[model samples]
Target: MHRRTFLQSAAAVSGLLPLAARPSFAGLYQAAAVATGDLDAVRGDGRPVTLPASAIKDLAASLRGPVLLASSPGYETARRVLNPSIDRRPALIVQPTGTADVRRAVSFASAHGLLLAVKCGGHSFSGMSTCDKGMQIDLSNMRGVRVDPKARRAYVEGGTLLGLVDHEAAAHGMVTPLGTVSHTGVGGLTTGGGFGRLARKFGLAVDNVVGVDVVTADGSVRRGDPTENPDLYWGVRGGGGNFGIVTNFEFQLHPFSGTVTGGEVVFPIDRARDLLRVYAEWSQKAPDEVYVDFVMSQPPGGKGGIALLHVCYCGDNADRDLAVLRTLGTPMANTIKVQRYVDFQKSGDYTDARTMGEYMKSGFTTGISEKLISGIIDGFEPHPARSTGVFTQHSGGAIGRPPVGTCAFPHRHAQHALMAAVSWKVGDDGAPHMAWAKKYWATIEPLTSGFYINEVNDESRAVLNANYRENFPRMVAVKKQYDPTNLFRLNANVQPA
Candidate 1:
């Protein structure tokens, strides 16, 4: 039986059917005390989970940056990550000023038997960057970007957001390919093989990685690149933060002049069949300079989904290239035009002003077959909520040519990736939204070849093994060498052998 079907059947048999059937409450966030477990929150190995007040004070004194406890001024804001679904309450939020501060935080967590999580842009979909009654080493204060125009390179601090990198790279008429959102942290994105508008032409963010300054589980500072500590370099390219806390990244930049002809064409649901058919045929042979995606979303105040064709062309003939995409179908709206790359990047950020609950599951596809297109259309029509939909991120071009086994990111040959996102208000019963996402995922999962570790929520050993595929053993070796005790078990963990 299909994996999702079996899981759903099992849940039904166990009285968990219709996930939205749980008792409902009306509130913006999870109950406050629920997040703050009783003073004793630590589990496993029977160690004392509670730390003395004096020890927290001492640790605060050691940090050059501020240490925020639950009572501090910015404690609430500091502890919150991007996803509202993750309402973890860490005991202390440590804002590290530099590599030294990061090292100190790691050492303190290890010595005191504290659960440690590393927070960069706080965009982790799995909420692995924060833990209950632990220390969240926030890199928000370390954002800094230095550009070497002559060498066509850039060095970005770990906590730096992709927006900052975009602005700085634009100053030099260059760019280091990153994700769609501007606020996403550079550390997590690059480490997980970042993909964005320029990726089809310039390659993934990891493909541009030249080096990294990292603080490992042992609190030792080290540098990894193509030469020195090559294995470490390989692991960090696609290995989530299981090995260490990356302090900074050196990237090779590409010239783009900060302008791209890109935008979206939206058509009513009636045109989906024709739109998807054309999109699948043309996108397969699209040039490296062109990036396009097929999206199905609920129109504002509308009953069903509208088909959207998103376009970005880096070549000179923007008008000529985009005109071909406009032929996808009769459109309800067409906004494709030449615009600043930075502005285009921000346009893709989540539209919700308040933090809303989010759940996502993504996988890679080798081609957009007719069955896949039909499944996508079927999945979006009866969306559980207006905030939920299925979309494809076109992937090819430079992404397909990376030297095999050069780095840990091995989904090089995938033609595109599909991500199913479900969103709802915090107070609502999340069962329906989660169930909707799972059912949609099940519809398309069989069409996919592999998964994108960054977009998935499943942490089961079986899922992790499948996500990494042939690269799993190598990642395990690296995990054993750097973190035998699983000090960084908060991510798509690659436990030591």
Candidate 2:
């Protein structure tokens, strides 16, 4: 079989395929290692837990979707997530096709004392979506997208990917605020406050969320919106998937021109110092409709890395804006042009290529100082791996304008959200790359105010606190109210008080 064909087939059975889309996996797993991790420990803080073989068999028989045991034919493939760094072995993998199926899985896991992990697009950076010797609720087959043009809303299944949302919304001349990656799970991203090229104008993916259909820890289906189950709604906005399994989402859509002007301009490393200094100045003065980011990464087939200034303008005066942007610095290449919004959306999604060991660390700051810029450039030049680099979201427009304490995300006042990401081959030692990223982040740590929950790699409880701030208390209250047992503790969890 052709190499690409093998990858496509592998991605399908592995439940890693993107929606409305293609795939990615290079040097992933040539051989699946059998897991021998302990299965009898308690998953949450409440009590000791255990799941017997007969109970697992009964749960398997009860599911409409296929139940794959560890030794089953497709079990190995079904268990892989997007990040190669995470290789967990769930005792039983249950694929759920609908909300009813999801409720059954949730109920079974809760009753049987089985640790539960949820998988949508399988894109969790921390691998919190799956666990060892536990039970996995796989929603890969539950993807469905419906757009109501007249109502200006789109109802997306929790299993849907950003690509499908973009495709459906574009057909109706509308768009939903989401992350840049086309294949990322819409459920995880939105539940944790998603943002993308359009976010500067539309706020966050959570901000556009109108309603949600969730299955709580008790197996009861509940709906949350501004007026109904308001506290639950607030918690879900940026609280990760701690409260329940979000089976469906209803998002308010924005009217779009269906066309955007954006692309990348690459400059040599020597010019990064000057380019970055100007980028800091431009980020503060740019219009809400103009979204751009400075990304440092190894140039394709090149020796050293280059700084790329990527621009996505969804507003008018593109010609004028492009002219002014070009003046930022001399470029080695420019790809900016008018294109369909969906096309532009697909341009920079690194996940479209292949899966690899990846780590992402984030920090949010209200301002970017010269020292921070220098630190970023220093981090870029000495990357330990080819894919190790850094970037920041110039997010002060719609993102910062959201009222404080409106939702679980507390970094709304931040003008920039910095991220240091590193990727490596499956078997390569990640220590050096991680160390480089840490060293890079250390130089700017004093300037950081908070962190983005979605991009976090540090699983420590203290980092989780920084993501929620004063809102952690309210989230704990809601978690206690709905998930008092902390059944949904797989994500960036807030232990029920």
Candidate 3:
């Protein structure tokens, strides 16, 4: 059976069983307080805001979805985000079932000056999707995907997972460029510039976006496309979530066979420099249908660290295109074969879920240099307890075809997105792992350019401005027009000019 089908069946069975009731926040708050009653929350400026019991009750009644408070039954589970490192407690969580619910939640936040955070897949590396002592608009319950095969377009709900799109689109031999992880939220991934196995062949996920239904700071639902609301459309393509909540995304799909020749070729860590050098030269001249990434890491239960070339070829000349990679070094293992694209997309799901604490620093590189290859190899320090690696997400095919100011994402000329990532288990001191990641990134940072907004952490305002380059001014102008109050400032924020 397919993975998703099995999971759904398991979930249905689990739902038949009874669940335990946890303690509510009745004692902590007023003794007579109900789940959606009076609450004390924080404002956007760190001030206090009190919501009367009646107001809370009205807000809950106005929405079609459930409003969760600290005393709510599913509050614990609803407050959790994907990154285990982030531990935030929101005053309330509003699980919106549709655009109307989202608009109400946004308007409530705006009116009350509440610190607002939006959670789709809750996959923000910096935990921008959830906040403390604030209101969280959770979209987990709004996952719905509809594919128009005839039109070659997908209408995906904002909170939908990438795997659902892959599954639904594959049913009709269609696919959209999305992030590699199946569980990643389409809202965050596409809004912040998505990269994946098929990105080089098609383009960044933002490039495929045809239209969007967004709710801005004023609680207004607007359609953004080429002709209508053109500026808003351009901003939503690559401008992170700084403008508003994108309730729905319309993606242009490409005809696909549902299978691709792809897998990893692994070699010992000692050959990383040579393999990477070869990769730098070969990947530049590779066909648009090929996407290859270089990863250096120690696999679980392996004897030592290794260098891997993760290749995905969609064209007919798969063997011819991959021949140069095979001749580079004596690979320990080569698993390149034709496989279902959806299955390939889920290959890293288990590993990604196992990661409890992760710290990553990423930047874009126009071209890989010999010094960079040496620096990457020298900075790599493999620890038996933790997973640390330097990897590259291949770029520079159709991704660079768009002009710089065509959208808010300005890193169009980048050849690769490089990252230094470290992961540690739960209860482990992440300081050491994070330190190592930073040290490793320092060596290669100078040779790289800007960062991918989706993977960005705690970067300074000036650095972010510089990274956005010449497009920052235009982005600010759009921000001022759509969200003059900067209600959506939790992302790689573009402050209103």
Candidate 4:
């Protein structure tokens, strides 16, 4: 997965290699030899706490998985997250192997009043999955996915990557709408309103979720579905990780042909404005099977900014729709072709990996207006050492079919999700890049209605409440009922009432 391969494959496709293709974590959990000592930790409110060496040893011995301290063999790697910009060391890291391990870890954290963070794929942009001098429940060792062809369903472990689900379901000629990136943790993505190539057709990942096995703040493993704990189920769909730690998810899968016509149509930056105007109108009428993204990026070391229309068409009328897109403007490069859906899902893996230091600001838009197009073009300033861009993921269709209050995700009427993003080298000074992104967002933010919770970064509680709208109170009630103490307050937090 080289940079050239990514560009040729359309780097905007959700990025992730299959689980088998990822690096092995075999020796990362050899915790038996690590000596236990008194641990200094922090409570959720930044208060200090300590666990006696005897208690640490007993807790380690209780779990079937490994308990990693700072001195452990793989502690360094275990603490690292996808965003290199976020560097925090937890007092102890618990690598859970199953639901039992998760329950024990949560119970221990609760008993000790230790600030707890949960890490799946470690792709949280805000670094909510990791914390300093706290306890981190790392799910890296729990990647397991099972697909039932007869039932057209996927049972994904809480720590499973989206790529694993894609691989397993594709084998059964089925698909579930997960996030855009294949390596994203299913737990964080689905709980935050998952969106991907097939989202328009099949709905979000949360929408497909039929049931969940979760460990709440009380360390109780509870099952939630329409019939069992329906309120909890509703809260989990779009309420984020505020309610509980989802140990397992049962998702309804849809039949999908293994192959689809998809790829990128790249145009010079000059044609961006006109093309966006055309896309604003054309995308509204596009069928459910047509999923597209408008991406603008100035690749590091590239000549200038370029606009790309990333297309994934599963319908029979791709030829007609694509022809219309090809005529939008003279594209500098057109890589559109028939490709396996699984392969397309992996196309952006290299790009995602390359952009280790990432900053993003995103919001849901009702439609692409002339003002937004102008704001995006005007604010986009290319940096020679960074990859900077503005992009839009097509929404609507199945996403809006469900009523606003059907689940916790309230932004059902948005037609597209717009984001301004910039990425630099891991250790480089990101201040300039972040400043640019914020300035760029300042112009477009006013045009947005609400935001997709997954991309939330540094937004205030007032903004969160406004975005959640009428559902905020209900989410607060669920949070109070499950996490009254706000144990899981790291995410797009819903403070308990």
Candidate 5:
């Protein structure tokens, strides 16, 4: 898709699409090809407490696949995340090659009374995908994508990263909207509410889903869709990793094509209020064909601030199309280049991919009002010297409106979303950023009540409950039906029956 078309589709998703029109996922979901790991070779015998080697032994023996106990050296390597602060200890780590192994692992965890946590790209701010001590089900190895071009659909594994999906889907001239960072796990983000550069045009990642392969607490695999186990399917869309472990996800793809012009445009931080006002006004009436996320970031050495705006044009009119910016302000640097959709997904991680640092985060207001803008301006004047401040980007043509009941994801038609994040070196400085993050957020919350579920930290308990609101109740009911014993209690929990 050229820049113009991409913008048009995005505009439809975020603004023009009817909420109730979400396609019903009524098809049967299939698991991956069965490998040697499909069979359960042994029975489990262990408890969450008493560290018994027998339980570990049984878990290993029962799996036709490989299982790594925490004591094993390999466990350390697989458990590491990009955030150094997220240090978790697991009793056992299982890498299931296929669904059968996942089933076995779930059953073992339930019967043996072991805590269960599932990891995708492991980008969760609160570390929901991993726990301090538990049974870790790492799906990072399940790299598979099957695209049906004629059907305009794709079946993606739970562990698949956005980068991989963007690369694969873009190849087909079809795309599924995903998060900003390509390294983010599609499962973790989609299971919550996925908003990507394409969101303004396409809708939530959950909105695009056709069906999902879910393993209930009973360890029995079933496809959740409108015609089969419909209730579970409803809950998984925006309900989070609560109902059960998702093995595969089927998505309805948007017609996407070739290179488009998209990327960063930085302006002096002093122009934040002006840019913010422009965003707020434009966001309300913006077409689905445009997606532009706004960011307020403090660069290194704390000189001043930057209005880091990320823009994507789905239409072929990059030349005459992007003159919209002149309405905003004089850009210090606007280097809009035409690049492949896959390359666009890789923009953020290019400088920091596979990098580790200490990070603290919170969420708040959509567009900064005069009051909030003043507070932000004041706050940026003197950030903790060792740390950098960031206000996450939120805006795009297609990201604005969806009915509340369309799916479990409730954040539709909301004006804006913002994340307050601070990243610093591990031992060098963690306290100042944490303190600043807390102070800044405390003031930011009065202006806004909603926040992104996937970008939270330790204090997000009450905030997340409020953020998703009524979706939680329905999620609980669905969780009861699929996992009565709460076997899949780890990660962003969906309470069981």
Candidate 6:
């Protein structure tokens, strides 16, 4: 049977269907939970079975953390993840206080044929971390990060978020290649070869990944890194979560913890044409210590604005980084100042926790021509009267090239990772933003190197092929070794070997 069809049937039979069918599964799961004397089964809506005292004792002995059944008060809180879009009511949400808890949860889920979801920062835009009516291995409480000042490496738990990583590393005057959004999860991002402001100078988030200890699908613990389990190590570097549940990551750190000079500069809508043109030109030859990014959004009036850019320099001279920006040209607003790296990351902070009915697209650019520029501009003009602006970033530095087949992230030599985001507030103007961006992208067809894997869209099937490119086959091989059944199948997926 097709995997999805089999999965759906299994879920229905196991009494773990989506919320729409949650009622039906609740009974079957409850019975299993009772019979096994373990928290193995759960209804789609998360109701637990009434177990006898003997069963409770057995379940408690097997758990590393509190084994929360659906009726428990903590069940509601334990069941939640970061993204609002994920409304999954798992049969059980196991907040594993430690590694043992995680293992037990994994074991139970596997034995019972339950769907599983792994959540760290809960910021996944694609909702891959949510299991509608199965098991959840939530690593929220496993927060721990220890940095080695001498070795310049950090031991970070799977639950750590980018913002926390930045804050802790800054305390030691050190840093690592992370993600653009501070709220992004370290585990998912690292596994997928994440990029950040430091990418041009250092590399991708996964490039700094020295080692990882994961709990595989079958409940076996394995260490993944270059020296041991080399294939699995490379697979996780950018392979997404096809292997297993990662518990910790050891990363290489650099002297970027202290304050540096950086911030955003907003340009008038009228200057977007010229500004983007200049940005495209300057980025090609920009230095290692400097990074440039652009954000174009639909603002009030008929005009869309440009976030001129943000630059971060790890050098001792803040003036040199400032000069890089000045050398580019004068800006309407340069918030660039002597500030910590964390401060720079927060400059573009969007406080609205509210996820919107948005149509956001992400992709990489090896080259952007005048024709492409016009198309992007045309897409922005009539978006949500006040929606996200364009975001442009430099690429291709130390992080750009690894063995091409080393990981799933393929755009090794690509130049820029740009995003075309069109979102709106409730009852706000949103149609124009979606229409404009989609049409503009259509106009720029054939210019983009396949869509970057992270920016997957229904029409962007070709993009995934490009993102993995030469490494696609290797990824399949590694995937098969760890997850032959593709239990963790989701995201811009690579079929298991």
Residue pairs clashing, model 1: 19-431
**What digit string (tens of lDDT, one per residue) describes model 4 on residues 1-497?**
11222232333323443222332445534453345456788999899998887777777778878888887767777777777688899999988889999999999999998899999988888888989999999998788988899998899999998999999999888999887667778999999998888899999888999999989999999999999999999999999999989999999999988888988888887777877887888888899889888877676665656777888898888778677775776678888899999888877664334335778899899998888888988777876667777788899999999987888999898899988877776678999989988988998999998998877799999998788888998999999999999999889999997
Q: What total of clashing residue pairs does each candidate reach? A: 1, 3, 0, 1, 34, 10
> Could you tell which candidate, 2 or 4, scores higher by lDDT?
4
Model 2 has a clash total of 3
Off by over 4 Å in 5: 1-48, 71-73, 319-321, 327-330, 351-368, 395-400, 460-462
TM-score of each: 0.89, 0.89, 0.91, 0.93, 0.85, 0.82
lDDT of 1: 0.76
TM-score winner = 4
Taken over the whole model, the C-alpha lDDT of each candidate is 0.76, 0.76, 0.82, 0.83, 0.66, 0.65
lDDT string for model 2 (1-497, tens) is 01111122223223343423221121111111222332353454435676655555555556656666675555676678777788888877777778988998899878866678888887777888878877788788789999999999999999998999999999988998898867779998998888788899999998999999999999999999989999999999999889999999999998998998888788876777787787888888888998878776552223555676788899889877656665765678889888998887766554343345667778787888887887776656443333656677778899988787888877788887777776665677877867776777777777788787776667588778756988989999999999988889888888887
Per-residue lDDT for 401 in model 4? 91
Error of 2 at 129 (Å): 1.0
Task: Give the distance in Å from residue 361's predicted Cα in candidate 3 to where it truly belongs.
Answer: 0.2
Q: By summed lDDT, which 10 consecutive residues of candidate 4 come out lowest? A: 1-10
lDDT of each residue in 112-196, candidate 6, tens digit only: 5566678786656556666666667777777788989889989998888788888888888899989866666788778877878
Model 2 off-target regions past 4 Å? 1-42, 45-50, 299-302, 350-355, 379-386
Choose 4 or 5, whichever is better by TM-score.
4
Cα lDDT of model 3 by residue, 1-497, tens digit: 01121122122112222222323433322322354446899998789999887777778778877778776667777777766778899998888889999999999999998999998887787888999989999888789889998999999999999999999999999999998878889999999989888988899999999999999999999999999999999998889998999999999999999999988888887888888998899888998899988877753233467777888889998778888975866678888899999998986664223235667899999999888888988867767556666788899999999899888889998999988876666577888878877877888899998999988898999998888899888899999999998888888988896
Name the weakest run of 10 consecutive residues (lDDT summed) in model 6: 1-10
RMSD to the hidden true structure, all candidates: 7.9, 6.1, 5.5, 3.5, 9.6, 9.0
When 1 and 5 are scored with lDDT, the better candidate is: 1
Give the number of the best model, judged by lDDT.
4
lDDT of 3 at 444: 87
